[model samples]
Target: MLLFSRNLDKLFFRTLEKQLALTYATSTEPQREEEFRVLNLKHVKGQVAPRRPLKKIVPPPPRTQQMAENQDWGNVWPGPRSFHPATVPLPVRQGYVEKGVSPGKFGNAELMKIPNFLHLTPPVIKRQCEALKKFCTPWPKSLDSEEKCERHFPVEVSSSDYCHSSPTIRDPLARIVSVKVKLEALKLDARARDKFLRLVGDRYDEESDTVTIVADRCPLKKQNYDYAMYLITAVYHESWNVEPWEELKSEADMEYYIWENNASKVNVEKIFGKEAKDIPQIEVYSSAVDKYMNEGESDHTVEQYGQAVRKILNLPSLGA
Candidate 1:
């Protein structure tokens, strides 16, 4: 009787489950139970399907193995894609192993994870360039040489674009913008040039004749570029500007010596009288003094100044 009751209960649940098509996993929503027999069965197991024979899975031979010896790799790897050992003919291996050689490419997770540029082979690159040539504009015939390019595009604004894996979307270096222009390109006079040099300090490359300003204070690349340009403009205009106190600057207060304004010129004029400016030796003395003062005292400059002074005074060389 007990066995019969259990069987009847089981049959009732099976019938109810089939009718409702509900499982304990699917009873996410609240459902009120009716009295006694209609109560929610906490352990309502579903009917299992009959077991069947399993079929085996077999992989085909590698594509590389079947490919001809002289097959075109360009066709095989048409574009960039994930690495497949079966497709690649090379015996690529990766992973660290102590005793044995590195694991073959067959199941190399490292190989699959890293980027591959098989599609960007020389032949493929040449083909791509040839195809793209039609879309590109021809080079300007006017700006043929590098010097001409520099003259035309004086402001060489440089910035970088990055494509890398990091926590942040934008790279710190990408935000930095460097503005480069030739010092001569600004067309600054002596006073303005001195002021500009003082303003830029080490940022000015004397060897290259370029003034470089790096702007990274702003967060965005465009803002930094704008800031760099603003700096260049400001320095240029400020150098040209003369303050009220500039007139008060005496020979002693000057940053660099002017050959025309110095006491040396007045002394030479006193010695030669009215004909000081007319003398050919006076010009040589002026050049030597100008170079010595502006370029700083050196052996070559000292020798030049000494020779010029002797020439001006009509002094004869003494035998050693």
Candidate 2:
């Protein structure tokens, strides 16, 4: 009985000791006052403070209707109220409309207004005559008529030295053959005159036998040619007193003067008269005259003869 009692006390003590050891091992601090307190004091020594909780940012209460109305901030008026911004108004111009316009037209008669230009001079008449002469093709009759040698009536040039745009006497012989003009002759007979007079304006002076039909302004082809002829005739008759022998500056001007004479054979005669009609001399002058008169040849201007002047003078060519 005593051995059994001793065994029971040993079992009881062992169980209690195991419970104490377990309790000691689990508890971080001493469970009883006499227990050893060996622990990691370094972790306890350094205090890790808890993180501060993030403050929830609650926005101020939405603007109240009464406050909005008072402040004039969020309150919007009704019926197409201009709450949004507007662009600056453009500068307004009222009721300014463009009108239609166009150029004017002139009648045939009105088109012919004479420029009230200058009277004719000798040089002017000569130049005009040269221009006319350039267009003068040989009449078809001249080629066949060997014996007759009938020539084209030269458009004449005569000028008074004293004439300063003053009207001078005209040569009766050089008065352009207005006798056969279609309009004038028509005017002479009452039968055809009125119709033509109506056709062209009343610029014709029937009593004076002086008819002025401006060709540029006139619609008729015959009138144009007649007007041209009349102009040449007027210049020729008006300039009759101009000196013919006055020495011209250039050979071309001299050639023009030579050709202006009524007689066609004068150029040949003039060359022969000066004893300068060598074969080469005749050739050069002939070439110059041909160039001036004939369109079949190359178009020759006055500058071409500038070289010929030195050639004619028997001077060596400067090649300028």
Candidate 3:
């Protein structure tokens, strides 16, 4: 029974080894066929899509060459913008010369980079004015004369406007408001005039008697304008007010020499005695002092002052 079992086991092993060799031969035959098929592909060329013909580029006609002399300028440029050479009809040129000739308008970067005011032609301005005429009110008949205009509009408000192609349209000086009015327009008395002058300081023009107030600290023009008007109103009202301390001011504290002051009046009274009012050259003396103090000192002013002084003191002239 043991020998029979051993012989059966040997037969089983032999059958298994033969089946393994057959399986290996079958797998290797398919792999060898795949390798031969891949090697054959190397000789074959790859297929490509057909190429299309390129279209020719046609250049545009020069706008300047096509434009006529009778063409409307307003139509060409309706508003302010960056310069464009092609749109402009003029034979304009820019760029520095390499030899004797400058670069023409066709491809001029310099011409296109800068600002242009071509839209603001005379004809265009006339047309714009005509269109805006309906919105504008007629000039007042009462303000026909310059004096009447000044009288009616006592305060003249001045401001500027700037236009450019930039990140901001606003200019620093554009917001500044300058208000001017004649000193006489305010109808201030001597005391008020002095106070107003003091309040305004150097802004008051003594020669022209015009007070000019400039407001620029504010951000907006309207705000500056309002501030200027408020300042003018405040100064005007304050000038009219009489402070108790102002009454204590003596001749020495006065800004300019006054004939009505204690020193001048007393001296004149003492010199002329009872006829102080009838003193000769009193008006001339006052005028001389005013000119010397307010107007300016000069050879003529000094001579006038000396003459007035000598006359007031009753000193004999060199001719006498």
lDDT of each: 0.87, 0.44, 0.85
Query: Pick by TM-score: which candidate is best?
Result: 3
The Cα RMSD of model 2 versus the native structure comes to: 36.8
Give per-residue CA lDDT, model 1, range 239-272, as digits (tens). Answer: 9999999989888899877888878888887878
- How many pairs of residues collide in each model? 0, 5, 0
Q: Which residue segments of model 2 deviate by more than 4 Å? A: 1-214, 218-226, 243-274, 278-281, 285-320
The lDDT leader among the candidates is 1
Question: Residue pairs in steric clash, candidate 1?
Answer: none
**Model 1 lDDT, residue 51, Cα:** 90
lDDT of 2 at 291: 54
Instruction: Point out the worst 10-residue segment of candidate 3 by lDDT.
Output: 30-39
Ranking by TM-score: 3, 1, 2
Residue 170 lDDT in candidate 2: 37
Pick by TM-score: 1 or 3, better one: 3
lDDT of 3 by residue, 1-320 (tens): 99999999999999999999999989888553433434656545674568898999998987877888898989889998877877887778889986987888878888877777889999999999999999999987877898888888888899999875678888887999999989999998898998999999999997987999999999999999999999999999999999899999886788776665547567777867854568887878777877877668899899888988888778987568
Candidate 1 regions with alpha-carbon error over 4 angstroms: 1-54, 66-82, 165-169, 269-287, 294-301, 307-320
